[model samples]
Target: MEEKILLKYIDVPDIEKIEVYQKHDGYKGLAKALKQHKPDQIIELVKASGLRGRGGAGFPAGLKWSFVPKDSGKPVFLCCNADEGEPGTFKDRLLMEKNPHQLIEGIVITAYAVNCHQAYIYIRGEFSQAMKVLEQAIEEAYEHNCLGKNILKQGFHLELSLHSGAGSYIAGEETGLLESLEGKRAEPRLKPPFPASVGLFKGPTVINNVETLSNVPHIIMRGPEWFKGFGTEKSTGTKLFCLSGHINKPGVYELPMGVPLKELINNYGGGIIGGRKLKAVIPGGSSTPVLTAEQVEEVAMDFESLQAAGSMLGSAGVIVMDETTCMVDALANLTRFYAHESCGQCTPCREGVSWMAKIARRIEEGKGLEGDLELLLDICDNISFKTLCPMGDAAIGPVVSFITKFRSEFEDHIRQGRCPIEKDKSIKVRG
Candidate 1:
């Protein structure tokens, strides 16, 4: 069953308005935090909740907040990553557009907990409607004493701003987002001086994803144990799973974190479209490895569970594929995306992904040679874990997974000089 916490009031009429949101206990968490809890207390509460980052990396949120130095002699900043750049993810966009105040409340509460007086939401450039909605919500927050000086008359001040990214996929990376927020090219930076220590103008900074921050208010209002009741002990709380491709219902669904993949596909997603047999599932965003039908049956949708099954619960962007979908064609499309978004900062990723794209496209186009698959695997070896950032590994995930899982399909395309699925059907390829 769906456990809609962050998205609880998303469908309510006029829920974006401050009055309506407040009526539904919108800023109650902020009120509770300011009235009853100290900044450190709030952080401890979050820590107790075990709320992990909802972005690709499942790092603990409170643990990240605690990394910011209290006596750094510099102002702390909180950056809410609203850049929903992953291919099969639309959960953040929906949260921002439909219930802006929920996100605003969460942001303000998180800012208070982290002792940040100034915060920013780095949203995707293409999300104009979400931008406009958030702008209005911010204005309402200030008017309602949820932001600005002496928030709720509790001696806390905050200034919130929104930044639109130039649609760079790499900016979705936390360090890269910080660089872009600083008006530089969106490239991932080297770690060691991680964001919590020296970030956003060299001040101690805390960056949280939209979905991650949006859960803060709920944790504060209901307490950590109440939040923990929803999902697994480690992966506590609900998750927004963006279901897409070859599903009967392709949209974001909020459910407990460890919901079985089969349950999500059948009960929530309404099963494969047109009654087609399930072939595979991308259990996370495009960056994660693909899961075959048998693997999907045994897996659950959570960080630890997916990782145990050789895939990460990355952004929880679930892309389903049916039997008619050609794996070779699908991989070619994914390789092209990673190739184009490499930022050129890493040679292994830049050149390796380009080579993978060309090789996959050749295979899909029926021009593949006997040694092409081996060459692709060789490129994967050179790229994976060899670049400065995870982009190299992410770029090769689908390439290696596809070939490893569906070698016969690639072989059929090569030997038959055409997509086997295409030769058998007049329908368009799902890829």
Candidate 2:
């Protein structure tokens, strides 16, 4: 219930303006870094703050920055992964739209900390309004000499570019985003030589999520101790949770890490719609496994706790479903999303996802055979960790999780030749 620290600038009038932002202690972080701290010291502070990537992977922010070889003469690039294509997630869009300068300030501070001279904000193509805000903010920053050529009178320089992807879910993946930025098809590259070692024109690069970078300015301005004061011990800092589905109040809520699921649903999300009984919850985005109401009450919304519950704090898209929602239909809907989004680069993902979607559709439609459940499990096992990227694993999470959590619903479809939850319609379908 605390006022949002990250979204503090959201309501500031003319927040995109550099002058307006600076008036509100916006560039103070870059100024502090420029005046007092060395690159390594800034990195140390970030490490101390315990900031993890909010873009899903939950990788340590400072650790990721440290991977860039400082001695490498190659130009280091800092890319803010603003291409938020994850289903049921839209927090990044709010940050970009309401407070573009906050993201810019954070990016500048992050680039300085990582000793990078150039940075890019790779926004999704569909976010036309967000793109406009960011572009205008960039131009304002340039005019104020905050973005290019000796920022804050320090010897350090930074150039920020706004690059939009052609709207692909795969583009949200780090390697795939890199490929898209290079003016090629957005397919993920192999990861022996990770992006920190060689990336973005084969130079040492650091890619961070938009939300992760947005936290930098605050960390630098308020000090690591102040920033670490909130959230759990391991997962520090507040997270922007996009609450949706059957909730009474379906909206974005910025809460600290380790917030109880019940509190988040009841207090922030206004409880379930129409006073319907809580059934299940996708703790993270669609990629995460659904948690039954009992599991939801026990699970805390954080990286470690969610992982321990056989799911992940992926993108913080909390989709709450009531008892009226059928698990079979939900799984089918999510499977279709992944199937449509697969880039067709790898056989397992391209084929396995499509196969799963087909079978799920059949099951949802009451045409499922007896062996279809076992076959679905088989497909999930093959696709879980055998592909080029996490996409395959993500594709299989819902299927495996749904069957495990709601086996009776799946069996009912196969046995009675109709979804048990929907007697009149034979199947449950809703948008």
Candidate 3:
């Protein structure tokens, strides 16, 4: 069943305006936090809520915040990871476009909770409409005293700004984002002094996805117990899932965190298009490992369950593929993307991803040799966990998963000298 916690007012007309948002109790959570709870108390409440980061990595949000030292002698910063670069993921873009104020209120409350006075929303550059809407919403928040100096007259100050990226997918990584925000190359940095202790401008920083921060207001307003009532024991609260690919009704759905993959496809997504048999599902975004149809039957759409299923609930980008889809061709297309997007910071990811793409493309083009499949797997082994960041692992996931689960298809392409699946020309397979 769908639970509209973060998206409760998403479809409400004029919800983007500060006046309309306030009328619907928009900043009440900020008010409550300012009046009743101290900074640490807010963190404790969030920790109790079991809110995890929604930006791929399922780290606990409250625990992440607690890592910031109480008296660090340097200013604390909050960064909203709005770089929605994952293929088939657009939930963050939708939230920023339709209900900008909701996100703004969430950011302000988070800044207050972590003693952060300066913050940045490092958004994807192509989101022009979202940028315009957010600019206006920020001004309106300032006019209403929801941001800027002495917010809500509580003597808490914050300066929120927006920085546009050059559409680098690597910038979605926390360290990569900090480098981009600092006017440097958008490549990830080494961790040890993690962002909680040392980040932007050499200060403690808390970076969270737009959806993750957007949940703060609800948790503060409704309390942790109420928020926990929606999802499973470990994975609490509702999540915004971006359902795409071959489904009948593909869009962003707000459902309980642990909704079954079958339920989401049948109930909310209206099942597969043309009533065709399900072939495979990428359960998360394109970066997560592909799941065979059998694997998805009973899999729950949550962090633990997906990981246990040998995949991940990455960004909740549910990409569905029907039987007509060609597995060899699919793997080739995904590999090509990672090959192009690699920052080339690490030798293994740079050279190995390109090699994987070349092999997959050759396999799809019916020019594969008998040793090609083994070679592809070998490349993935070298790339996985051998880079500066997880981009290497991300690149290898689809390649390894496709070749493992659908090895026959790759073999058929090699043995028969062509793609075997007769794809439907009328139905388009979206990213």
Which candidate number has the best TM-score? 3
Which regions of candidate 2 are displaced past 4 Å? Answer: 1-3, 423-431
Encode model 2's per-residue lDDT on 1-431: one tens digit a residue.
Answer: 48567887777888777788888888888888889999998899999999999999999999999998978889999999999988879999999998888899889888988888999999999999999989999999989878999887898899999998887999999999999999998899988799998999999899999899999988988889988888999999999999988877787889999898889999989888778799899988999988999998888998999999999999999998887888888899999999999989999999999999999989989999999989999999888778888999999889999999999999989999988784222333333
lDDT of each: 0.91, 0.90, 0.92
- Give residue 201's lDDT in candidate 2 (0 to 100): 92
- lDDT digits (tens) for residues 1-431 of candidate 3: 45588788887899999889988889999999998999999999999999999999889999999999989899999999999988989899999999988899889988998999999999989999999999999999999999999999999999999999988999999999999999998899888889999999999999999999999999999999999998889899999999998998999999998999999999989999989999999988999999989988889999989999999988989999999999988888999999999999999999999999999999888899999999999999998889989899999999989999999989999999888889864745544
TM-score of each: 0.97, 0.97, 0.98
What lDDT is reached at residue 51 by model 2? 96
Please give the distance, in angstroms, between residue 255's alpha carbon in candidate 1 and its true position after superposition: 0.8
Candidate 2 residue 262 C-alpha distance from true site, Å: 0.8
Clashes of 1: 0
Pairs clashing in candidate 2? none
Q: Provide the lowest-lDDT 10-residue window in model 3.
A: 422-431
